[model samples]
Target: MAKKWDLFEGYLKCDPNIKAAEVVTDYVENYRSQAISEEVQPIIDRLEKAKADYFNSLFDLYEKEAEYMRIDRKVKDIAGVNYYIKPVVDFSDINLINEPEIVGAQVLTTRLFPTAVKREKYSYEEGAKA
Candidate 1:
């Protein structure tokens, strides 16, 4: 019989940073547990610092994942059919005409982020008035 591995193994195998992220997460959880269980003030403070370090590491990992996703989107758009990505939410009533632009406004408005189609939904009273 052959050994069977789950799909998650493929994801974990793709990036070394993911392993580091997992290690940091374990440390964070351990420090959190220690902070909760122990009553010593100094030890709790030290654990908090350790937890912060783990959080910072996880943030860096997340940034790398974001960069990877950006590049992956580009590649997929170039090679595959143009389509909307997942995790989209529809906000049809919000107006952004007077809103000030922030950094990466173009990317956010595009397929990478959730789109807000500025339009009103159909209502009985509004329809009757129209």
Candidate 2:
């Protein structure tokens, strides 16, 4: 990871155009600003990149949610029914007596997708009264 920072530093130093060098230098500076250790710049930059990527992914997901809701239930049911509506479900009767280690949780997270099960609307008058 240090190699990446070294490379970026070298690029900033060697570039003839001050503007280009400044951009790289600024990015390097911003990316590494949080780290007090000079040697940790690469790690910081990698983390910053990861943070940006993660945020963008979350943002893109929010933008995609509109289309996800518009899709009909029949299709979702076949894909595993109503899975999307409550996709990534979890319920547990178990309890931890103490703070758990990393290995404690055995829960699984499902991909966000709609459920396919057709929920029949209950009508008292139409059924029993009729």
Candidate 3:
């Protein structure tokens, strides 16, 4: 009868977090148990630093992935800018104003950046009815 290597190997593979975590606990215990010179213990310290560097690299990758989703380049010249800034929600921003009631509502109030929208849409101090 042939032995199934894949089935046996499946039990051995562990999650990186579980594996790294377990290795860390074991490393600490092993280091503590060994008879050693005071100077030799720094090797264990190096392992901790290397483990930290590995996780830091993983974090840096995730941040880059998030940043890549944004509109990357800003138009330098004002005249060169265009409608809704081409999908960028800039208040000085252009956005999908998603009030379902206002979805089809015309932007009767679009004023490009630097070009002021002409209206007295608000009173600096409107008093309530007494």
Candidate 4:
């Protein structure tokens, strides 16, 4: 799956006027700002805790309820991105954990596109005169 950064890179490549390095730097900075913001920090913490609890419960044979609790938790990414976390089942022969699925991420591209240029239209006579 193509990431948001990859899309930004492609956008920069399509527009010769845009500097790739500058745009990438700005994008990274924007991501960092959002990651550190108060609104997103708690979500990050909760995900970390969930992952830890899930693993700890998985090792302990009697912690089935805890494992289920971890699975029930809906952990979203910092930018409100939702990715699938495969639930580990107790079945030995059956492998329920599949490949990591990347759902989607919210991209902030307010300044990515350049301003539209006005084009002049001319009739056949106007073109002939020109």
Would you list the C-alpha lDDT of every candidate in the order shown?
A: 0.49, 0.48, 0.42, 0.49
Best by TM-score: 2
Clashes in each model (backbone N, CA, C under 3 Å)? Answer: 0, 12, 2, 0
State the local distance difference test value for candidate 4: 0.49
In angstroms, give how far residue 53 of model 4 lies from its true place: 0.9
- Each candidate's root-mean-square deviation in Å? 26.0, 21.7, 26.4, 22.1
Stronger candidate by lDDT (1 vs 3): 1
Clashes of 2: 12
What lDDT does model 2 reach?
0.48
Cα lDDT for residue 99, model 4?
30
Q: To one decimal, what is the Cα RMSD in angstroms of model 1 from the true structure?
A: 26.0
Instruction: TM-score each candidate.
Output: 0.27, 0.30, 0.26, 0.27
- Model 1 lowest lDDT segment of ten: 87-96
Quote model 1's TM-score: 0.27
Tens digit of per-residue lDDT, candidate 1, span 1-130:
1123233354457854456566456547664455445434544565598679866965775676676776666766776665554311212333432333323554445534325544333333343221
